[model samples]
Target: MVADGIVSAYPVDPEDGPPVGISKDDALTLKALMSPVKGALGYSLEDARQLYLKERIGVGEDPRRHAARNRLAKLFVRAEAGGLPASTLLVDLTRQQARDVRDHMLTYEKPGGGKVAPASVKRDLTIMKAMIGHAIREFDLIKAAHNPFEALEVGISSGGEEDIAARELKETLPDAVIAAMRGNLQGELNLIWGLGSRHARLSH
Candidate 1:
């Protein structure tokens, strides 16, 4: 039954990883990491990784995978129709998102299993905002409007939120480098470019 739903309505091959097209497993991990800022930030969980694996690879499947899969599938179809190749930067962004999600899952709870720094939600938010910025730069794409990632000013700004924001991310390389990916994509790309504009709120 579940497999049928995934195959029919989803319309995505189990191997087609994410909006940018990575391994399905990588997409799933990123989905988990972006869970906290889902609706308010429109962050994607790529939950389909586990579900796809469950249906096709024999691992445990998660139920929430459908939404993310649907979202990416739609993006992929649109991008293909529009003639834009999937950006390598976007693929890298998804990969990083997956890693952060794994880190949060392992570190979120204490030894007994509880929230560590309940007050630091903002800090996490800050990290997320920076990550998004890096995504844009790494992909070397500009946005159509203002960057939502810059507006994500939601993290704990204790002493120097300004300073942290100022800190540079090594992953966000120079513009020419990211722009260099033109025509190298194998899948979909965001309709608009840039970090400040493409951000979506997290509902979960």
Candidate 2:
């Protein structure tokens, strides 16, 4: 959903969950880390990171939140490497700039030089959208018209064909094996089989 073709229907609120310890000193530090002004592109990006930390870290911490923060931090570094100055205004980020970031994520390597999964890249892009949306709708830091991320759609190039192939291979159990399992575990096997079939259908 959207509002006036500007704000998002779902706005992020830091206070929605348990309060976080965003001390005055820390806030000042984050602000200083940003470009002296509030609406600079890097400043808003930093604010988005702060929002994610406040909301996801307030009540408790988990692997998922940790992963999300790390992904965003990595993307920020990539943006800097791509020549976007810390003082770039939020309104100045172009559609091409956003696309460049997506492209970079597509080939991003893991710490051990392993390929990053498409699903992981997709998740990071989704987080980027949410961060930009929150900046626009909740913080009123950037006007929706000036939000470059608003026009972009994140998609894996191969339509997740690799994932489908992996799932198919996993489910191709032999009839004899399936029969033995069903015979040994009648009711449990029935439930499991039904769920597996339902999941396969939904995946299509």
Candidate 3:
């Protein structure tokens, strides 16, 4: 018999023997055949987060990247406190839940006072979307088309031309100011900054 694509393997009584008509080896074979399929859909968000971090560490990810992921996890924990529980299974995550998560993130306040910036909220959501996408792909859970986090908008802007222009604006010090700042710096710091500036110019 099969339910939800899972077949019922032949039963074996460990303390006794295989049931009625089945031999031990045949039961074993059935049991092996019916082993649970592993995938991200079977994991809770927190569990998947842990697995992702563990994998990154195993592959020697940079310390800063690990710290950033931990920060994101903490943010998710806070969101859980607000309503979006980390115990939510990936398979059960609905689009409404994803929106609720974004809403909670937008409501976060810095320790000093101000609400989190829209840009920061957008960035956090982007990272979260990427993480979930990676987990889905890594576990071969489902097609990329099925990712619930895909194409989620943080509602940061009205998509106005002015907003676009403001975002694209570049702020930089004048050449004279840069030279003055370099002159004020001492030894190795100055050397490093000079080399960096030269490389930046070369790249551009």
lDDT leader: 3
How displaced is residue 52 in candidate 3, in Å? 1.3
- Candidate with better lDDT, 2 vs 3: 3
Q: What stretches of model 1 exceed 4 Å from their correct place?
A: 1-108, 144-149, 153-204
How would you order the candidates by TM-score, starting with the best? 3, 2, 1
User: Which of the two candidates, 1 or 3, achieves a greater TM-score against the reference?
Assistant: 3
Tell me the tens digit of each residue's lDDT in model 2 across 77-161: 8766655443454545678877777667666667887667766766666766776666556565544335666646555543343
Assess each prediction's global lDDT (C-alpha) against the native.
0.37, 0.59, 0.64
TM-score of each: 0.22, 0.48, 0.53
> Residue-wise lDDT of candidate 1 within 1-204, one digit each (tens)?
433333344335557632333444444444435542332222221322223334433423344455544534443343333332233223223433333332342234446755444234444444434444544443333431123434433333223233233334234545685566534533445334433223521211
Candidate 3 ranges with C-alpha deviation above 4 Å:
1-41, 57-66, 143-145, 157-165, 168-204
Cα deviation of 164, candidate 1, in Å: 19
Quick one: best TM-score, which candidate?
A: 3
Worst 10 residues of 1 by lDDT: 39-48
